[model samples]
Target chain A: MADQLTDDQLADLFAGLRADTVAAVLPPGADAARHTVRRRRQARAAVTGGLAVAAVAGVVGVAVAGTPAAPPAEPTGPLPTADRSALRDLAESVLPPDARSAAAWSFSLGDETSNTAGELPAGSYRMVVACAGDGGTDVLVRWTPRGEDNLFDPERAVVVATGETACAAAPSPATLRFVTPRDGEVMVSVEAVDGAAGRAGFAYRIVPAR
Target chain B: MALTTDLHPPPETTRAVPDFDELYAAHYADLTVQLFAYFGDRQEAQDVVQEAFCRALARWSSVSRYDDPVAWVRRVAWNLAVSRWRRARTALGFLRRQRVAEPQVDGPSPERVALVRALATLPGVQRRAMVLHYLADLTVAEIAQREGVAEGTVKSWLHRGRAALAVQLRPTGTEVSRG
Candidate 1:
């Protein structure tokens, strides 16, 4: 009987699906979207401009150069031991002062691991994943609700947010901000891009947005 | 600096870019619906669409100058959805080995679920072709241009995809069980 269904019938079915789905969605408003884009722009500008260097110097009491105009060259061999405290300081320098730490961890390239940050009420939070090496390495970071922590289980994990950042001489970091839909524990997972599992150390911290 | 130039193009060379607010207002719901039909997850679809808009806004100076800015936004949203889908598929495979069943959430109508399930069974390219053709009202040439394939390839995909959907949705077949 289905063989009798024509193209018009299939189109009608799709049209019905479209109407039902569109009616159920409530857009987060253009104003809210504009605000998000503005915030992201400011963050990227801060990172790439002199503001990041100034902030780091102010917080750490050391002069730091602006991020180089040219891309940092890739490391050929093993990287130096990651300075955890220094990386943390660099990460915190770019975030709001009131941001409270929820979880922090360190890992190497080619390793996929996750950290659970207990339960958090519906609110905004920031994730800072930093990589410290001579140069060229990137890490993928993902956030998912806790019980769904099977980093391998994509269907159920329902990733709330994700980002990627390259490693650099300084603790080059990729920062992502997201809001929890409801009160729930969340897990943050980090995986390095495929390559030699060089000791290019990485660190990530999750904190509540002020 | 190049960044400065990108942010503030010369007045003489600048074109009349569409208002961001108006663009968002006009296309947000439609784009979200298209993504929802593609992925079968309302929240995820909305998120990806919103993220795509955010990206467009960030690069508005460049994006707004495009011949069809909405196409840029749609492409970005589709790219994001595809990346997430790939990650999910990888995770689903691992979980399948562990015998962990994903929790099902109730929302869509029975008819919608049946169609979505049938669509899900098709290969990714074919399913995408079906949705883009039937739901988005895109012609074969348009889909071909967007997908960077020949129009004949798109026609074949649509033909095969429709035939498969018919078999899956047959009334007497066990494939689509009605509620």
Candidate 2:
């Protein structure tokens, strides 16, 4: 009688015998998806981390301290339409000579649907731009220069802000060539919507881009 | 800018959340008791089976499409158990190397440990077939379909694996077969 049981019979007997035992074996179904924004952010940062850095072997005949790595610059505020055109100017000014008038870029800002256009010089690069804000209006810019197109400089300033008038002071039209010496800091003078001239200075400061 | 992606992804992913209740109702105890007999350690086997089942349920949308769910679950459960053994092999190597200038391991030798470890080293399918026969109480025809093999092939391997397991289970005999 013991060995004569068919597979279905055995399965049925197992179901009858161990229903509670099986339930006991199941995992304590905690919400694997539940986490605070802080935990979520922490998880993202852990991805691809702990990679042991290996020194590249090459002979440049002379070697100094290897290229210094810097933390990613924090994102700034949302770029308005005018800020966008200014960003194009910034990217253009920052990109090398061959890449100056000829580079492709992708821009996302405001609530409007957006995309990148124009043939970016060297034909190879990945760039993402957005309005950065703490749920407020702001502009965010991120880009990777690589292969032949890696000539884009990470240090360039295209606009100046003094008081509430941003991008108000443009250099001489003829002097507007791709390169110009950055003369002064973009003095950000934030005040209430209706405030007097040179009251207390802005509560916030925008550091001049390198 | 805050850019958030769903860590749990969409319905099309292997990472989709599980329907834990339904899976529990379906296969929990059968797999646990079965794995317990297979590994001869009920609590550890239960744990490994639970983890593997949770993993399976987490990835059910993808793994459910496999040809043999039982075989799949058993393989995952078995690997989780054997992983401890693979780790333990290094301990054996260290103990062996201690013979360079250390006290001898004296006793009526622990040949049983070597026998069990040797049984574990066989190809997973042969081992599973043997397990289903002895421990799970499944016939050759039952094992054929469960393991997704032809009936004739199942009988052939079961015959061979039985001989091997018998030798491992009993040290003094010249192996026996009954078909």
Candidate 3:
């Protein structure tokens, strides 16, 4: 049956299906969507801001009593800075104590790949990638020996290692360990594997392997 | 003053960000349609897509800078649809035992209904592969990357899904002989 039907025929069928579905459903207007989002953001900020203030007050009270106060969690403030710091901390937490940072990058990861590269001497290293977002997209991490120029050329460069980590509020870092054959430039790239379009605050670091 | 302003003109970095309203208006209906085909519920599909847009709006400052910001909204919407469908499936199972009658809505064309039903028969991975390939117009390599599977795996899923749909939708007397 499949041999009898052409690719165009199947595509037409699916296209028709989409058209029919669209006719049956009416999506909300952009203004409505924006209003709802703004309201939700305000509500969430109110709740989280209240909690953060209470937590800080508790820590200050403890210090006033002359108790040996533990270090307080990072205060939440602006969205971009807070997310960057949180993702950086998450990426750093996965590194070994003796690991020295070679290169680090922070970016808003979408469907397109994000890359960061640096020169390194001959040594074993660990690459850690972390992402945080509202969606369930997973970030794929690929390490290649050549610069970005040859990153896509299979003949010119071979991918050393690959791993993936989910994008979440509390993300599990993806780590890859590989040894450089010779001292040269190396590139690491990250992209969302899931087809859905969403954005995440992503941070990655390269450190000496213990 | 005019010469100095022309020389500097402030930074154009913010120009890279896309307009949220335009993006939302352009993609809302199409994304809802895709989600509707994935799960056989139009209202749920619209709701999930709306929720995804809402999430994107909350983080527009960063999301708008992405190379393909619409892709982010699409992914988030699909993720929401998948999770919601899972929860609905569980509740539906219990409701079936109680013989609950579902609310009636305007129906789709018979052919569309048949295609969706055939798609529903497929495994989740195969269905997703079919939808992404056929509807989303993604290449085999793109589908493989999205699914975290090899190209061969994605090809196999698409082949099997097409075969299953053909078997289900083929007419009783239709047959073609290979040369």
| Highest TM-score model number | 3
Cα lDDT of model 2 overall? 0.35
lDDT of 1 by residue, A1-210 (tens): 544467777777788777777777788987787798556444433343122211110111112223543343332444444553444345444433333777665555432233334456766766665665422222223334545543333334445665444444455455556666666655554433222125345566667767
Cα-based lDDT at residue A167, candidate 1: 47
Provide the global lDDT of candidate 1 against the true structure: 0.59
lDDT of 2 by residue, A1-210 (tens): 222333444334334323433444544332331222223223222321111111111100111111112221222433455645553354233322322322233222222212121222222121211111111111112122222221111112221111111111111010011111222211111111111111111111111112
> Second chain TM-score per prediction?
0.77, 0.49, 0.79
* Candidate numbers sorted by TM-score from highest down: 3, 1, 2
Off by over 4 Å in 1: A1-3, A49-210, B1-16, B92-106, B172-179
What are the lDDT scores of the predictions, listed in order?
0.59, 0.35, 0.58
Provide TM-scores for the models. 0.53, 0.33, 0.55
User: In candidate 3, what are the lDDT values of residues A125-197, reduced to their tens digit?
Assistant: 7655555543322222223453444443322343455443444455545555666666666666554322212
How many times do residue backbones clash in model 3? 7
**Index of the highest-DockQ prediction:** 3
Give candidate 2 misplaced runs (Cα > 4 Å): A1-210, B1-19, B64-71, B92-126, B133-153, B161-179
The TM-score, computed over Cα atoms with residue i paired to residue i, of candidate 2 is 0.33
